[model samples]
Target: MKIGKVLIANRGEIALRIHRACQEMGIRTVAVHSTADAAAMHVRLADESVCIGPPPARESYLNVAAILSAAAITGADAIHPGYGFLSENANFAEMVEAHGFVFIGPRPEHIRMMGDKIAAKDAMRRLGVPLVPGSLGALASLEEARQVAAEVMYPVLIKAAAGGGGRGMKVAQDESGLEEAWRVARTEAKAAFGDDAVYLEKYLDRPRHIELQVLADTHGHVVHFGERDCSLQRRHQKLVEEAGSPVLDAAQRDALGAQVTRALKQLGYRNAGTLEFLWQDGQFAFIEMNTRLQVEHPVTEMVCGIDLVKEQLRVAAGERLGYGQSEIRFQGHAIECRITAENPDTFLPSPGRVTTYHAPGGLGVRVDSALYSGYAVPPHYDSLIAKLVVHGGTRAEAIARLRRSLAEMVVDGIETTLPLHLAIMEDPEFQAGDYTIHWLEQFVARRNPAR
Candidate 1:
């Protein structure tokens, strides 16, 4: 079951991150990329590289046939689909396994189960995970939606069953708005995901976005790496994340962790996964589960001192988790700032040459990026160019370190979110960790009233 070589089916920082982990584990890496990313850092550092297609992602990164062909050409024993792209694709996972390469993720059935939001919620409910009160499944009609909204009370959320990144989601302030919200949500869902199926959930007014990171092995051993507070987001896309949330004490962490691990074990889940929740009034309601590594996984690693990517590799190779939940411990606090190639104020994509690149360096600072001097930031992929991670003895210390690191870090010749992150670090509310899922949007509006 030893994985000698792995094919990285991704790009940018995450692809480089997986390559580094494979290198550390004495596994050779095959980096697959589009023609536009032939010069990417991961492609350059890999033992072998393959060009799958043109600049557009549809022709390249998501091209399953080309990626599988590359893996075959490179003799890869496994395929590691990093956080995005084909990571949560159940069909791709099945194809990878069908092609005789280990897919370093959850089983296809698990991915398929969680890919559908309604099915995932039902499964979690059966496994003792708390869910927000709403419709039992996709609403069959506007009347059904109205009934569910009334049952859950007004101010409900209409969400796409196959949606993420805030797409296909609308808020109905009251019964008067439910019809339009439902129509808009379904339309958006169909246009975006090719599926118009939408559901309802009781909207918690001031819930914090907290997620539990869990790793399960094929041997039935599961462990949790605590929780991350990702409430600092704009439009449902997280900008900053903190490990071991400020409001959650050790007791709270243990209780949630125990519940998550137990539930995942009962479901027979394997590999890396994250269970997202809305925490309000000292209670957690399961929202959804991401069946892949998260973008902010480094923060969890910093606090738990576990190499999640390596664990994924091991589990995919049919190895058992050597330790149990009790053995896993949370250490110092960690924070991660997702630095994207976008305007700080307008938040528009800024893809161009990176004339100068310098990442922060210190005892507890880590930069996961693929950017370099003279590199062209591709316009075809995700705007995220780098992730700045910092660890410290406490949340206060982590903020201080993050501020210092942000000052030292530099990405020139293109607009980046560095300024925005610096502003966040300086804000008192952010420093105090007195924020919720709606905090960032309000903060941004306050900063720029014109927008």
Candidate 2:
């Protein structure tokens, strides 16, 4: 089950991260790209490169057939589908396995179950995981939606059953707002995921987003690398992520981590995944499980001293998880600020060639990027072009380190969200770790009134 070559079916920083991991493991790498990503850093660095399709993601990154063909032609034994695109596609995973190539991710059934919100919640509920009170399945109609809202109380959330990432989600403050929310959620769900099925959930006001990083192998061994506080988000997209939540103590952290590990092992999940939760008042309510490596994985890696992608490679290659629960250790605090190619004030995508770029240095500062001075930020993809992660002995020290590193980071010739990140680093509530999911939106509205 040894994988000698890995075909990375992604672009940008994550692809580069995978390439580096493969190279360090003495594995050859192949990069698949779109026309727009012809000059992507990952492609330039990979041992072999292939043009998958056009600039559009549907024909390029999301084209599972093209990705498989690239792997087949390039003689790669494994394919790493990074987060987003087809990373969570169950059919794609099945196809990769059918084609005799290992998909460096969870089992196909695991991906399928987690891709559906209703199914994922039902499974978690059966595992005795804490869930926000709501329907156990998709709402039958507006009548069912109202009934569930009555049972769950007001301020219920209507969420799409098939996809996540903030799409097809609407909150109804009361019964009067239920019908419109349901309709709008269905419409958005169909447009985004091609699935109009929606579910209801009790909406917790300003709950903090917490996720545990779980690693497992085919040997039925699973372990957790503590928790990450991803409360600093904008419109459900994480902007700032920190390891070792400031709120949870040792007892709570261990209990929750053990709970997640047990649940994942029960399902026989493999490779790396994340169990997201809504935390408030020391209680955790299950959100949804992400069946792929998260964009904020660097924080967990920095704190735990684990190369998660390397572990994923081993797990997918049928090797046992060599470390037990106690073997994993958490070090000092770490924080990650996602640097996107967007207007700082308006948050609009600003894709163009970077004229000048300089990375921050010194101890505990790591930059995962695909950007160079001449690299062009493509307009056809996600705005996130780089991630700036910093580590320190204490949370306060991490914050201080992040501020200094951010100040030293320079990306010229295009607007970026660096200004917003700078503002967040200086925010009082942010520094105190007293904010919630909705805090970022309010913070921006108050200060950046024009946008």
Candidate 3:
């Protein structure tokens, strides 16, 4: 099960990240790209490259057949679907194994189970994981939703059973709003996920989005890598992420990590996974689990001193997790800002040729990006262009380092969220770590007023 050659069935910064890890492991990489990414960084750095399809994701990155064919032709021993695209697609995982290539992720059943929010919650409950109080399954009718909402109290959230990214989610303040919320949620869910099934959960007034990173191997060993505070979000999309949350102590981290590892062990999970939770009033409630590597994994790696991608490769190659939970240490504080090609104020996509590109450098600073001076920022992919990460001995020092790094970063010829991140770093409330998931929206509103 040695992964000598890997086909990276992804693009952009994550694809480059995986390529670096493979190179470090002495593994050859085959970059699969669309025609639009012919000059991308990962493609240029890879041992070999293959054109998958056109710019649109459906005809290219998401095309399972094209990716499998590329792997077969390249003689790749495995396929690494980095983070997005087919990363969490259970069928794609199965297809990879069926084609005699390793899938560097969890079992297909784990991916399929976690993809369904209701099924995931149920499994978590069975495995003794804490969950937000709500319906045990999808509501069959509006009447059923009403009963569940009444039982859980008002201001309940109507969420699509198979949704993410706040797509099929709505809030009902009271009974008067329940019917509309239900209808809209179902409609959105059907359009987005092709599944009209919706569920209800009691919405917390103010909750911090915290997630635990866990790694498991073919062996029964499972360990958690503390937590990340991803509360600085807009419309449920995280912009800033911090590892070893400012509010959590070592005791709390250990307790939650123990619980997560135990639960994942019971489920027989494997590879790298993240368990997302809502933290409010000192209690953690499981929301969902991502069966692949997360975008903000660098922060965890910085604090834990572990290479998650390398560990993923090792575990996928049937290697044991030689270390255990006790050996894993949470060191200093780390923060990551997701820099996207968009308007700083309006959040509109800004895609064009980059005239200049310069990433910051110094102690404990890492820039994960595929952007270059003359490259064209394609509009076909995610808006995220780079991740600016910084680490320090303390949270205050981390903030100071992040500020300096932000000032040093230069991405010209296109609007990016760099200005927005700089403002966030300067905000007193953010510096004090006194914000929740709603804080970003309010901060943006206060800054704009017109919008």
Candidate 4:
């Protein structure tokens, strides 16, 4: 494979992460930044930089033409979309290819199929992948949804087919809830993703949000690295993640991993992708596929000792995968806590300047962030400030290390979820890995007694 220049089409920590990988590969990098990220760490460290557009995302990171122009002007051969923005936008992927730049991810068709939740579920079902019982297609009317819910049984989950990041998701326990859920879900879906299409599924109560990380090349070779348990969450957002989910046994892991691998190979998947599953009562059901790298990727990387971003670059360059499933091995356990700028309880975006910043450092501790002392936390983008990842020989050790790391981490001048994370570490349910998706809600309730 010919190694050349690559363009990073995102900002902040992820952009820097890709840049570091490209640098290691001795490849030149072009960092595209919005007006808000002009002085970001990624922009300053890149081999070259381009101002894509203004502070807003639609006019900037999601602007296909501007990103293509940047790649063309910078002489970049590939464009790497780091996780969000237009990362999984099939239209943008096609545009990149049309402009003679390789997209460092799955093919355009895969993105389109997975971008729509309903379509992705259909594809999974076709490949014999386990999916929750619910409407096979979009519910055209409230009556239709009610009928499907009756068959699949409630409480059913109403999700925007074209939405992600927990933006357009709700629970409808019965027929009455289904009617109002459809309208509200569609409204939020259209506003967030410009697509109001939605689908319903049986919402498994107290399911662990486990996901398998898979890598594939154009050579038809695909393998699951491992699974990450992201059950500890708030409002459908993951707060803490760990590799080799304590919830799954060896036989269960192999079964779920093999199923996901078969589905990916059948679909001709390539590059880096994640198959999300809702695990409950020892049964795994496919939720969706993220056709881009994930935020919790570092946890898997830490355990597997692999540079996923570098592999993405290699695969996009038409190179075959370096390691097969048998060659990959999962070592010790690893955990990652997403330190974000938000109200501990309300979970509202709390962006502001970092009057003082201190990132924890020591053995077995890794901090992936773009924050620095006195740097302003721009309100123009996601609130994620840093990821505190730690590895240990055992799950208990990893938890202890994570607790210490979070305590040592300091980011002043903005209210963050640090306190909440601390509380989580101290929670007995969390310490024992006995919590589920709704654990945070229950924990908060206990933190504040009834008025």
Candidate 5:
């Protein structure tokens, strides 16, 4: 049951990433793109290409029907949903499999269970995985939310039942805050995910966002590739990610990975996914689980020397994993910086033609991007322009390399957050790995001196 060909059901760097992995495996690739992405790097890199629909995500990347049709026409045996778009859609996965194409991800049921925040937290609790104390189920009403907050104690978090990317989340410190927060959170959730249900959890003050990467197969085998510290973020959007988190000890790392594996086993998960948590006060609590591959997966690949995309394809082809936990080794350190097309100061999108683009390269430097010097960055999609990844024998060396790479990197014509990234590397707290989720807010406040 070897997968000879794969239909990449997304665009941008992730699509190109999967194409490269497929090429190494000798598996032909078919890229499905929108009208705007006809000349995208992913399209040019794939062995074959098909136009799905218009530029909007809903009509193109998220259109399950068109993707299935493309796969059928291209004679692809499997589909890779990269990271975003239809990656987490359980229905899309089911449709792909139903159309006689393997979906390179976990079982649809597993995706459904983990995609919903409330169900995911409950699953973690049932597996004896430590979770942030909160309501065990979705809130029935605002009164129920308040009661749960009262039971969990004040300064709790209100989150969308089916949410991510920091959308539909609010912090309430008092009864007054709970009602207003709930109303606003529900609205945001509906607008973002079309889900109005909200849940409650105790807020971990000054928490570090840490996540474990786990790869499992249809067989009853699961193993972790260590953890990534993604605490440096803006509005819950990960800006930088690094493997071998400086905050965790060997024992803590083992415990965290074990907890994630046990929880996924209980839920009967397969394929590659991540367990996200908030680490605070020397303890970790399950926040949510991503049923799809993450954007920051390259850092894990660099440190572990395992091509996650290849493993994903192999697992989807009904093959047992080639290695065991003992064979898995994490050596050295790796860091990834996301280069977004945005105003450094205002943080607003700045999409336009790329007048100049030069990705830094040398020892311990890798750039994953879809942009070239003359590529016109469309205004319809995300602002992410590139991902700069660096690896070194130690965290300090990795930081130094990243600093040097960032200094050498050049992108002209449009504004970028590179300047802000440069500033962060110079910050003492960030350099020391002492920054938390609140660090960015505080940094902006200090820099602007006014809101």
Candidate 6:
């Protein structure tokens, strides 16, 4: 069940990352692209290229039929849906399997179960994972919502059953505000996810985002990489990420990792995935599970010294887990900064031609980017231009190395978040690791009063 030729069903740096992994494994790769991405870095490096559709993502990246057609024509035996696009779509995964191609991800049923927040919670609970105090299931009506809120106490978070990225989430302080919160959350959920099903949960005042990276194989073996601290984010979008959270003790980290991997192993899960948790008061609460490779996977890979993308390919080919949990080792602390094409002050997308794109070079520094000197940063896609990752023997050394690497990085002709990252690297609170998810927005407000 070896995968011979692989088709990449994504664009940009992730595709290039997967391409390099396949190259290293001596496997052929087929790059699928839209008209706008024909000149993308991944397209240039692939063994073969296929144009799926026009510029828009719906007609290109998300068009399952066209992607399958491209894979079929290219004779690719497997498809790697890199991070976004159709990566977590259960229908797309089933379609790929239906077309006789191995989907380089978890099973379709696993994807579907985790897609809904309610079902995912139940699954996690059954596996002995601690969850945030919330509704037993999705609320059906305003009355149900009220009942759950009463039982769970006040200051409950209304969340979309099928939502992520803070889109369909609201916090209600008391019963008086529950009705409006429910309505608003439902509307947002419908508009954003096409699913108006909402749930109730207890809201934590201050919580840090910690996620455990897990990998499984068809042979029933599972392994967990140490967690990543993604507390630095805006509107639920992660910016800077680091391995070895400053707050968690060694015992706590190992316990949480063991809990997550054991859960996945019990559920018959396979492939790469992430179990996100809210860390508060020395307790870990389950948030949600991401059934795809993460953008911050580089940080985990840097510290663990395992190529996650290659492991996905190998697992999809029905191979056994190459390395056991004891064989895996964490060498150093790693940090990653997502450098985006945006205004440093306003945080708005600034897409245009990259006049000068010079990546930094030094020890413990790695840059994953699709940008070139003349490559035009497309407005229709994510504004992330590159990811700067650094590793060191200690967290302090990692931070200092990341600062040096960020200082050396150069991207001209388009405004970028480079200035913002630079300021963060020098900030006292950030250096002290005393920030949470809400810290970035507050920092920006303080830096730019009257904005």
lDDT of each: 0.95, 0.93, 0.96, 0.89, 0.90, 0.92
Candidate RMSDs in Å, in order, are 0.7, 0.9, 0.5, 1.5, 1.2, 1.0
Alpha carbon lDDT of residue 439, candidate 6? 90
Score every model by TM-score. 0.99, 0.99, 0.99, 0.97, 0.98, 0.98
Q: What is the lDDT of residue 393 in candidate 5?
A: 99
1 or 5, which is superior by lDDT?
A: 1
lDDT of 3: 0.96
Question: Best candidate, lDDT-wise?
Answer: 3
* Candidate 1 Cα RMSD after full superposition onto the native fold (Å): 0.7
Q: Please give, for residues 191-235, the per-residue lDDT of candidate 3 as tens digits.
A: 999999999999998999999999999989999989999999999
- State the lDDT at 397 in candidate 3: 95
The parts of candidate 1 lying over 4 Å away from their true place are none
In Å, residue 265's CA in model 3 sits off its true spot by 0.8
- Model with the higher TM-score, candidate 4 or 6: 6
- Candidate 6 residue lDDT tens string, 299-363: 99999988999899999988898788888888889999999999998888898888998999899
Clashes per candidate, residues 3 or more apart or on different chains: 0, 0, 0, 0, 0, 0
lDDT of 2 by residue, 100-211 (tens): 9999999999999998888999999988889888998998899999988999899999999996789999999999899999999999999998999999999999799999
Clashing pairs in 2: none
Residue 186 C-alpha lDDT in model 3: 95
Ranking by lDDT: 3, 1, 2, 6, 5, 4
Off by over 4 Å in 2: none
Which residue pairs show collisions in model 5? none
Give the poorly placed runs of model 3, Cα more than 4 Å off.
Answer: none
